[model samples]
Target: MLDHLITHDDNLRMVPTDRNELAAAVGHLQEELRALPEGSDTARARVLTRWIGIAQLCLGHHDEARTSLRQSLELAVTIGNSRAVVATGLNLGDAHRYAGDVRGADALYRSALITARYHHPELMDFALQHTGKHLMECGDPAGARAHLQEALRLRIAKGDAELVKSTQAALERVELLISQADASATGHAVPGQWSRQWTAWLQSRITTRTPSRWAQDFPTVRYAVAGLTAHQRVHPCHLRDQSFPSALLTAMAEEAEKAVAADGYLHNGKWNAATLDAVSLFVGQVDLADVVSRSSGLAVEPPHTAVYIAYEEGQRLDFHLDEFGFGEANLILCLKHERPAELPRASTTVFLTADSYLECDLAAGDCIVFDGALTPHGRTPLSAGESVTLVCFGFRAREQDSRTVTHLPPVPSGRAALGRPESAPAPRCATLCGHAGN
Candidate 1:
């Protein structure tokens, strides 16, 4: 019933009703118990162990609590203390009940009941009440009723109005269920016994034609689509927090560094450099492409691919998209520059005509993609320094019409095409049809 404030900030609070939260609380309390000095005080240990056992029971961590409380109970017995032993036994029984071990709970309750009779009558009453609950679970309602009724009488005699009221509510529900079951066993008919009458009555509640809004309001479920749409355009500047595998960037950088040093100069369009070789790992992580595609809404097209490599300072791209005709998305992966570069401030700028231009100054693993249709986009001139490299993948539909030309030539007959009039373009129809007049 206790609501704990999990955080020290005074605002973060949680209830123990949630299973995960209760389990976490048990873990926290265990840590606190472990911090206590060994043998500091047996009474204090007993108190902490009791609460810990209860927390574990609520969390459904029964075996863990049983182990903890059994040890504490053994210590209490060695000290000739009945109070702690009796309390721990009652808690152990509770844990057994929660784990659906009715017989084990009954044995523990019986032991606690004997100790409670001599040491504390209140605890004896508690044990009896729980024993009755176990009896009910074990399918002995008569025995359960006897124990529960006696427990209820004891509580009333002790003048505990709260316990009496609670016990009375339980007794009433048991009696009501028993009576209804007895009545149902006789030759009397229940409301739904007449099958034909019941079916007609239920059918009257239904309708052949329901409201159309019901169909719209309750939509059918659909699986997740791992692609992007070009219709929902996104700016290239939005991918500031994209995370990439670290090993990938290191391998790519090492590859690129090896290439430039070996040849005295790096060549364009050839990924043979050490950097490009390391790009395969990034490409292997298909989920990253799905994330980018969804964010950018690039049309689901052929060649779902991505490339990433590290770019040291002084590297530059002249401006080009992949060989794929339609440029859907370009992702740039960048790493932070440790120091400034030698040639002009190292920033990649895409020149989209004179009026509209875009510049990207990226940190490590940052990615962005844009539709090539929106003014030509490219990076700025690179200087000699640490800059980020990106593997850009362009996607297109799996299948596309091979015809490159948009316009069609005049037909030889000039007759109406199949399913189209002669006035319409030949491309609109698959083929032409001959008419006698032609």
Candidate 2:
């Protein structure tokens, strides 16, 4: 009877199988296992239970899947079936992850990874891929990249074309995210010295091409008429007034430097690539707010101002649209660059698609305004030993009438705001962090 039920379960593994058929098959196998005397055939019971769990998972019954998988895992351990234990561990972890039990999922994945390393190489590959996917979603791109890259290597060596293609697609997404993170120049400037030779090398790469007609006419194109109409807009430097008043530019730069010096750079965990270095003094102190308001034609209050400085080599910002709360109107002022001549002719480039992008070069004090929440923008990697500084300001359309007085909204000043959400139930594995069943 056990062997007949096992055959039925094996047949259900075929692809394009019907879910209803699978459920019925699982139910039939379950009934046969239960008909036998309790505890009479523990090994067969474990395998049957695991098959049932898999069927439950396919049907989106995560709770039932987890319960069945947990029982199968306990039996596998008792029977010293390391391979079954590892497989059950992975399935249980998936069930927990689907149920939003992140901590539980992490624990199970870690346990499976450790157990698979000693049991089967294929099990290890699956564990690595699943763990990497989890980390990628949890804002740990660096960690995810490491795991996925290794998993890809292993899968390729095994000559699994389908798995190779899926892993490659996942890896590409991770690489794109890393590129954007590198291009993002947010955070305070840590005091560091650049050799004169480094500065000279950067300057040598500056483009000295003659300005195009469009470039020359850029300044006259008002921001209100340009970027406000669509998701993004670019205004070239006006030929007549290519720069802001020298005093205002100097003051803004000085304030930026001072803020970095005083507060140090702040790291935002959401995009693990860059940090927030300095913020502009409020509306009353900086004239840039008025400039942005006038140019964008938004009844902008004093903007949330911040200075972003790129510190790492090969760092690039990822392409992403901003959130509405950041502002309806966003302005980026090019305050400083390593080579003035190579400063892009526009603000940071905005991408229309993965393969195409638009950029504008602006001199110090030259600013571009766009619908911050809608534009997908990012920067390229800075050359070795080179750095760029940008002052970012956020503004709302006047009619929105938001009461947000600061760019970084303050956390409510009470204990209620500090409460943590309840965590998921812990995994049953004894040592989730270290070697399991070793």
Candidate 3:
């Protein structure tokens, strides 16, 4: 009976469209489990329960799926089936996540990641990807970037081009959010100009001392320090000299054009006017981690890269702060800027204070490095017949703690972790950008 049930369930999974067949298969599995004595066929019962949960999830019955998965997990634990435990945990997490229980979903995913790290290294990618995706939807781009970057590294190491492409796309979405957040904080209004004497005075004060020392020297300005610890502090922002080689810039620009043609432009809404993915190859080829480390005075890792394209008629980026994780430091390389000869040149501006802003009209191949997470910056909107393409690479400080780090307390027993099933209607299926709970 167990063998027949397993075979039938497998068939149903392969051809999931037939609701009647799926219902019949689930019924048979439930009947078989019921006929067996308690604990008599634990392993078989676990398989049946897990398959039933999967079937329930596929049919959009998330509550039933949760119940079945909880039972399946309990059985797996009882049998010491490590592989089954990991698999069931991931599925259960997805069900919870898609059902609008972000905290609950994260709890499950963290557990799965811990389990996989110890017992099933092969499942690490899946655990990370799902967890990252969940974090991204929850408005934690930094956390999402950390996991997604790690996942991308693993995929690239394994030479899986398809997975690499998908992971890269996910990272791009996170970057767009970070840019938008920074724009919102800075505001779109044109800032007033500062006198040259004022600019020189501020530069002299900061250039001669470390950020921590500067804070101490100017105690009154310390209140504006944003959020930097003395021990691992660096300047809030700085520009690097000739960061990108001319040839590399040209290659990156070509790559961006190709990607835009293949993937089409992504409308990011109030964040980026448009974006292109999988254009980070050149960035990865360079020793960006080292550059960021030296420039920011913090141990940093290689960047997660993307190409941002702004159109003449597109919306301008608003002033906002970057989230902590991937936004610790960012390197933006201007690739191509084509504008009408009659219009004034456009520039990227960083707001230093209410009375002053730093604007740079970067030529092709020029790059700027800044503490994106702590500073507010945005670009002036392009004029008619103007378009600009930029290669953006974001690096995280190695010593900086990730904001998503959570202490997972021990979960109580089966179904209790999810609380009693709610009377509320099941959530709609998860969408790409919205809440994962479907």
Better of 2 and 3 by TM-score: 3
Q: Write the per-residue lDDT of candidate 2 for residues 144-192, one digit (tens) a residue.
A: 7657755765565455787777677666666666546543442311101
Q: Give lDDT tens digits, candidate 1, residues 1-438.
A: 223522111111112456677676667767877888998776667666777777766555789768777777877887778887887887788778767888788889899987876567556557777776667656655445556655664565456687777566555554454446544554332211222232232223211122222122111100000011112133454365445578776676565455434532233422222223355455666355465456655444433333333345554543332222233445555533444644445545342222122445555555555543222344444455545544455444322332111121111121122123335322210111111111
Off by over 4 Å in 2: 1-17, 172-438
Q: Give a tens-digit lDDT track for model 3, residues 1-438.
A: 222322222211212567667778788878987998987889999988998887777666889989999999999999999999998998898789768899899999999998876677667767887788888878987688778866765565445687777777777776677657644554421111111222333343332212224223332222232222221233434343535566767876776666445543344222221122234445546777776666656667777434355333443554444444445667776778776788764534333322224455555765666665444455555556767777676776676463222221111123223321345232221111111112
Overall local distance difference test of candidate 1? 0.49
Task: Give the number of the best model, judged by lDDT.
Answer: 3
Cα-based RMSD of the predictions, in order?
Answer: 28.8, 22.1, 18.7
Which predicted model would earn the best TM-score? 3
Give the Å error, residue 45, model 1.
1.6
Q: How many collisions per candidate?
A: 25, 23, 23
Ranking by lDDT: 3, 2, 1
On lDDT, the stronger of 1 and 2 is: 2
Order of candidates by TM-score, top first?
Answer: 3, 2, 1
